[model samples]
Target: MLRDFSAQALFMGLLTAFVGFASSFAVVLHGLTGVGASEAQAASGVMALSISMGLCAIVLSAWTRLPVSIAWSTPGAALLASSGAVEGGFAAAVGGFLICAALIVVAGLWKPLGRMVAAIPATLANAMLAGVLIGLCFAPVKAVAFNPAFGLAILGAWAVVGAFNRLLAVPAALVAFALVLTFGIDIPDGAFSAIARDLLPRPEIVAPVFNLPGLVSIALPLFVVTMASQNIPGIAVLKVNQYEPNPGPLFAATGIFSFLSAPFGGHAVNLAAITAAMCAGEDAHADPRRRYWAAINAGVFYVVFGLLAGAVTAIVNLAPPILIQAVAGLALISAFAGSAMNAFKEAETREAAALTFLTTASGVSFGGISGAFWGLLAGGLVMGVGRFVAARKAKKV
Candidate 1:
């Protein structure tokens, strides 16, 4: 089989989807908590996000013959969670989301800004991106520490799958859940009730109302974080997969979709790196020309999921903890190591990167976003000052 349809390609695409599904749940949960949302509201939001990402991925993959996946802004959720109090709650988070979406749409329509983003040095962009993902992976590790058995089970499953079979490795999290269920892990009593509630018939509307204060506090930080963290890396994924994607249209579409769907529960949307990698690879389809089918399949799944938001959330709630933690930890390993690698690569810049890493790891917060934003700022400043000093010394000599 793989010889016929490109097993490697399929594996990559599936791996990407697995990561998106597993790691994103944390961010989604955070967003839901920030807003003090009802289970239904939270499900609706996730559903919108799933649909937006899935649809965007389908369009891009189909048109470009590349593996492309879309996802919600992870960094945006962090920003919302931190500054949620200031903005007065979930309503403000929604406002901030709308503003972020508008900015993306505007940027997409503006050629110069898009080109400038594209012109940034890949190394620096990647480094910045790595800084963003470091903490995301760490979050799951922290969760696991409090639940040793769950964590160990997840770890064991990951190790076994990774060592024994490459294909199994991507879906190991899903498998771990089955094991947990088999062993009769203690789950929340109302888990079944939640699941049943989600399955009930209902229309797809959330009655999103605008709040100026929330937009002001939430918008700028959310936009910057999304661009710096998710979109930049998403673009990088496309390049690595040999897809020279047009970032402008992609960003624009994501913005439009997010803006239109925000009331219905969608936030900022952007390209998906991990999932895109899989679709771009050869294994996703037998004919290179036909890989669009996978993307189309993803879109269909996303729309269905979005429409059934409640049920999906309930299902996620029921999923084994080990499955979530292990999958997130394993999938994010590459991102974590990559950030650390670049942070210390150059002797002259090492100090700056080190400062950035430490500050970010310290979990400092300022102006809504955390040290991930400040770490980049601090590193850039250090590098700038060092360069300026070096130039002056050379002139003096």
Candidate 2:
């Protein structure tokens, strides 16, 4: 079963695996900044999530002979940076992690909640995903305005790779990344000395505190956003890749990871769809049995990356901000388009789906949870009622 392991496959897999870790570091750090975390705390949390995901991915993938890669939850990080930045600060952000972990643990333990989540319709889920990611997509366009040259370079690279995908195959993102780096396009600029000085080999943990304001206003909303925005799409990615594992165990693992790391500022952990797709593809390993090694390879890199957290931070800082924004936006384009298309595909329920999309895009917040979750819920309820009414009328006839 472990017969075929080409060097090329290993290289592609490893490259793809490093993507989210490297790409999202800036955003994570920015989020930390928003929450008033010192640069050191922000970097440490990033290191923790990277190392934890790497370890978990290695064990799970090798044990199951499946290509299971994990990354810091992008949506979770986004929510933390935005809302968790307000009111309660970093400690409040920790509260968010604790709340999300507890809820996930309960869901993992009780099958009913999982089932209810599963019962949500596919189109609606896609719509929710689109809404959740709309901000991410438009972010790059805005970045171009900030730094036209760098943003355009990244976009141009994407266009070149996409046009040649048939010939270039899986190396497109890698090539694009290389070209941007080589072209003297600066995305961010953190000096090597500054990064080395800021490195934290040991992390300081902040114990969970229960403030009604923190939990209800901050933590609860963050939890809702993580579950609704991050977890759902993560699971969908798994299903899309035909590696749909037991949801209970998966959620359990995430909860356990989150619970353990919350005090140290670890925000959220979940199965990664974009990065995971790299491992699931035929290119990662022709023989499915050995594909797990690709994830193991990624995990190994993650551990190594964790040890060099300071250097990694420095490197991210050197890259231009526009590059980060453009790449992130470009990477997520397919996901956004897919979600939007599904959101409005049906005639009868299209209006409800539109409501969800618009509300989510508006970025409104009642408490801590982003509008994406509430938007989907409200739209889904309306659609469900419409279906129920139509079915009842048909039965009477």
Candidate 3:
């Protein structure tokens, strides 16, 4: 392992962690707050998720000898942001999070259940994800309308960097955002003082309420989105990179960590898709076997970043809301494009996929369930009917 260590690998690992965290940390914060968490609680959630995913990445990579990078559930965060609030407030949301984590653990331990999750149609899943992302993707353009100077600077930086290296684009945009925050706008009074006071993140134990409505709405949708959007794509990334570790144990590890972190504000942790590709690919190390060290290095950095969550939250709070959303939207543009492509890639699945995308994007909610869940159900129904009709026509022929 020591022989495999190189400056290039180290830099790649650090860059992966930076890009992953900087790109989506705001989404996590927004999700937590949207679920009714206080500022401190949201900060705690960020710290917990960062630390949990980091430790999981480190342990899994060292043990499996694969670049098994872990990440906080970004789509799950998007689900939370779109779902609004539950009946019992943050405590209920916390309970739902616990349920979601437990379900993941179950999916890991039970092969049949895992297969069922795996059997979810990729088109429908991707369509649902596209729906979730479509709203946020427009934020950059909206921000340009709201505050041209701040928004355009970030967008321009992303566009320029993306032209050279797509992986670095979001992080570059984040840097531009920070520069604009520093020089373009006046710092909010007492923001620095708040940062000093909350320099260390403190875990706030939210007692779980277990409301039925919250469980059905938040817990179920969170589990489905996490598995479909994050884990499945993550495993595919590993396979494409010529690494196939036992996903069962990996799922269990992430689920266990997520379960442990739930009471302290973390939502969910799972196998990473985007950042995992960074660590597992040739960019991290020439030798695939040596790439595990890059993941280990990234894990170390994630923990360090988590420890500074309080300071990070303080700085984020000082930024304009539109600018934050705009940066986040820019970060997700690649993902949105990928998902949209996958959703409509097949001729047979096009109509179903379109329905899923439209329903999910419509933000329709019923019986306390989220639009994502409803959209998937609607799309799946259409797909099933289409298949049935095709089979009947074939029999007649």
Candidate 4:
């Protein structure tokens, strides 16, 4: 393991963790608060998620000798953000998180269930994700309207960095945001002190309370999004890079950690999609056998980052909510683009995918259920009708 370590791999691993967290931490915070977590609880949630994913990455990489990066479910967070507060509030949300984690564990243990989850159409899944992202992606423009100076600076920084290295764009924008906050705007005298007080995150366990509405509305959608957007794509990423570790055990490991962390305010954890590529790809290491070190290093970095959750959360809270959201929107641009591309790529599924995207993007709520769940349902119905019509046409011909 010592011999396998290389400067390139170590750098790549740390870079992946830094970039991933900096880009998306806002979304995680927003998601937790959207579900009714207090500021402290949200900070705890971030810490729990970071530590859990970190441990998962470390253990999985060591056991499999593969670059198996784990991540908090970004799309799942987006789903929660859109879903808003349910009947029983944050406790209910915690219950839903537990349920989702249980589902993931079952999927890992049960072959047929895993197969069924895998059978979800890629177009529909991508469309659902795209729809969830559409509203959030508009935040930069909204930020410009709300606070022109700060907004423009943030957007400009993102644009400039993206022009060169897309991966660095959001992190660069975050830096620009910090600079603008420091020099461009006035800070309240005691604000920094308040932020400093929360520098070290303390876990706050919220007891889970299961209810039918939360189960259908939050749990099911969270499960679907995490599996479809994170887990399935994560496997594909590793497979593409010629690392085919067993999916079941990996899923089970994430599921277990997610379950353990949920009581402490964490949401879902799963195999990473984007960062997995960073660690698993050739850029991480020339020798595939040595690439596991990248994942290990990433895990270590993630744990350290988790320990700094308080500071990060405090910094984010210092900004206007819209600005934070704007940064998050910028972070999700690539995901939205990718989802849109795949959602419309197939002519046969285009209409269904469009229906899904529109429904999810609408942010509609009915009977306590989120637009994402309704969107997937509506899309599936359309897909079924399309298949039926195609079959009839074939018979007539």
The lDDT of each candidate is 0.62, 0.66, 0.88, 0.91
lDDT of 3 by residue, 1-397 (tens): 7887878778988998998899898788878988899888998899999999999999999899899999999888877877778889999999999999999998988999899988989899889888988888888999899888888999999999999998888888889988988888789778788689878878788998898867877898788889988887788999999987788888888899999889999999999988998999998989998999889999999999999987888787788877877877887778789989999999999999999999888877887676877898999999999999999999999
Worst 10 residues of 4 by lDDT: 193-202
* lDDT digits (tens) for residues 308-361 of candidate 2: 775555555566555565565666576578667877888888878887777766
Q: Which model scores highest in TM-score?
A: 4
Candidate 4 TM-score over all chains jointly: 0.97
TM-score, model 1 to reference: 0.78
Q: How would you encode candidate 4's per-residue C-alpha lDDT over 1-397 as one tens digit per residue?
A: 7888999989988998998789898888889999999988999999999999999999999899999999999988888888899999999999999999999999999999999988888899999999988888999999999989999999999999999998999999899889987887678898888778867778899999999878988898899889989998899999999977899999989999999989988999999999999999999998999999899999999999998997888777777889989898999899999999999999999999999999999998888888888999999999999999999999999
User: How would you order the candidates by TM-score, starting with the best?
Assistant: 4, 3, 2, 1
Clashing pairs in 4: none
- Of 1 and 3, the candidate ranking higher by lDDT: 3
**If scored against the real structure, what TM-score would every candidate get?**
0.78, 0.80, 0.95, 0.97
Error of 1 at 161 (Å): 1.3
- Model 3 TM-score relative to the real fold: 0.95
lDDT score for residue 198 of model 2:
63
RMSD of each: 4.6, 4.3, 1.6, 1.2
Among the numbered candidates, top lDDT falls to 4
